[model samples]
Target: MALTIMIADDHPAVLYGLRRLLENAPRSRFVIADAVEGGQALLRSLRGRDCDLALVDWYMPPERGPSGRELLARLRTTFPQTTLVVMTASQQPAVLAASLAAGATGLYDKRECSSQLPRILYQAAQGRLCVSPSLEIVLERHYLTRYHWGQENHQALTPREREVMRLIAAGYTGRETAAQLKRSEKTISRQRRSALDKLGLNPDSVPTLAPG
Candidate 1:
């Protein structure tokens, strides 16, 4: 049976291109069930009809509705049976990591869509996790940096400090990290300072410690 797909992107050209791409992918059994231009339209379409997969753009205009991990998360919760493949032009490893953490089954870089999207869709239809090569490299560096930080400072910091550092390295603001860890922002800031000092990292240079 052919896999049915729903596409959601804020750009009309992207919607048209994706629809055409999936419809014409050689040897692939895919059907374009619906193509919509924003999150609201996508949700409306999905409520009225089910599809085997959904391809969503990671960033869309704020007026269109939620974007990024929030959009992926909503789709995952509301339509658990539909496989989600997120498309992004962002090079930030944190964005890619957050998408997977939010339940995306596949990550496709917009730059490689014409060459790699078909295989990504096929793998996602099979329920396999797929990460584009470029995106994978970014994530790999993120992990390696965290590993190095651990190796160098594991004994120097307490567990809470380590946890705070990890979240900070993953792009969370101090306040967001505090909310996630259920601590006060002041406490999070203090822990972050301690962790950075122990790691011999300047707070101003934290962004350089992780891949963006």
Candidate 2:
């Protein structure tokens, strides 16, 4: 059966590019069911509908649309059977980890593309957790940490702390987060420590996404 795919991104260029990539490839294997520009529309149009896969942008800016984390979780619930593949421009470890925790079956960095994208999308439709190639090592390390150390208390951290923690979990050192956030290493460390402290986990250990 040809895969039924939906593309959702806030940018016209991105949505167009993804549509073109999937439908115009030399041996296109997917059937473009519909292309939506915003998260809200994507969710609304897809609810109660059966689609094999959905490629969603990590960030969608419309006011009525759910963005980032909420968007991923919502999609998982709203369209339980639809495999979700989050698209992003960054290979940040935390983003990759969090997406999987939130039920994303695939994570694709927009900077990375081509035939591999379709392969992962297909894997996702088959119930596998897929991530960008460059991110696999980072994912292997933090994939456990995201579930064990951070998820339960994720709601406790400040926005800044969450940002710092995601990078740290992604295998980025404090220096990396500092440079990425344009802040001092001390500030990044403090934010990461604060988030970890709030979550009651030690940075030295890796845990599952849901502790039972």
Candidate 3:
């Protein structure tokens, strides 16, 4: 039997192109689903659709506005057996590293969609890691930087603190952040203050925290 595959992307053009690519492949059976955002894709996959691979958009609007990392972490935990492949245009080292750390089996640069995808998908299906060469270079540099930065620097923030920082960076007001984090407004305020103080990130500084 051929492997089952699912593609989750927000852009209509990318979705159409991906469909054409998969449909033309000669070796595997693929199941494709279109979702405007990440949550819906997770919902459909969790319904026991039995996909062997999932090609997820690197960024998507969250269902309830949760961070993309949180959503990806949830999906990874819930669907441990499915091979998750990130298909995104983001070539930033930090972005690629985060996706791989979030349990993606492979990271395919969207620019490589024309010819590289089929081989990457096939490799991922066989339990091998796949990542764009550009991303690999970034990952290597990131690894070296971390080695120099020491584990202590990396351990500075708790997961919750990071989440709070991310939400704030996303432009969520205190009240909105409180609701999203499921905490009292006062608690959210405190968390934000603490994160800002630690990161030396000025509360007034504007940061575009891109999803995931």
Candidate 4:
């Protein structure tokens, strides 16, 4: 069955290009149910109609409505059944991580949308966490550079510590991470502190790395 998709962006050109790409692709598994400009329009369309998935730009005009993580979070809350894929031109690890934390099923770099978007969307449709290769590299480099952990130190992280660290690194708040892991906030804080100790990193210097 062809997956029904709703797309939203601030630019008409982007919406047109995306629609044309999906509509014209040979043996495409997707159908454009609706293509709208801006987050408010997207929300309005979703409220009136149901689709299998939503593809939205990360940055839209503020006047149009919430963008970035806030927009993704709202979509996730309001329409849990529809899969979400966020398209971004940002190369920041924090932004990428926050998108995932905000419930994006897939992350696609706008630069590679022409060639990679279909594959990314297909993976998300299949209930997989899909991230663009370029974006993955950016996130990896950010973690490696920021942590700078020795092999021994890296191996010292307990499974829970690793989980907490991963969520924290991904811009989740301590409360959110704790709730996600089904643990007490105190336990999450302890685990975070322990992980920081093992990595020999100063919590204050790392910003989000510090336990709340």
Task: Between candidates 1 and 4, name the one with more favorable lDDT.
Answer: 4
Model 4: residue 205 alpha-carbon error in angstroms: 13
Which candidate should be chosen as best, given TM-score against the real structure?
A: 1
lDDT of each: 0.79, 0.74, 0.67, 0.82
Tens-digit per-residue lDDT, 58-85, candidate 3: 7877652333466568778878888888
* Clashing residue pairs for model 1: none
- Stretches of candidate 2 exceeding 4 Å from the true structure: 62-64, 141-212
Candidate 2, pairs of clashing residues? 93-170, 147-208, 147-209, 148-208
Error of 2 at 109 (Å): 1.2
Expressed as tens digits, the lDDT of each residue in 1-212 for candidate 2 is 78999988878887787788888876678988888888898988897777989898888885858867898788887788888888887666667656766777788877765667887887888887676786665555543443452255678889998887677657676666677889887777677667767765546543212211
lDDT of 4 by residue, 50-114 (tens): 78899989989989988887898889999999999999999876677777777788899998747
Instruction: For each of the candidates, give the backbone clash count.
Output: 0, 4, 0, 0
Would you list the rank order by TM-score, best first?
1, 4, 2, 3
- Quote the lDDT for 84 in model 4: 93
Q: What lDDT does candidate 4 reach at residue 27?
A: 83
- TM-score per candidate, in order? 0.71, 0.67, 0.63, 0.69
**lDDT score of model 3?**
0.67
Give the C-alpha miss distance for residue 174 in model 2, angstroms: 14
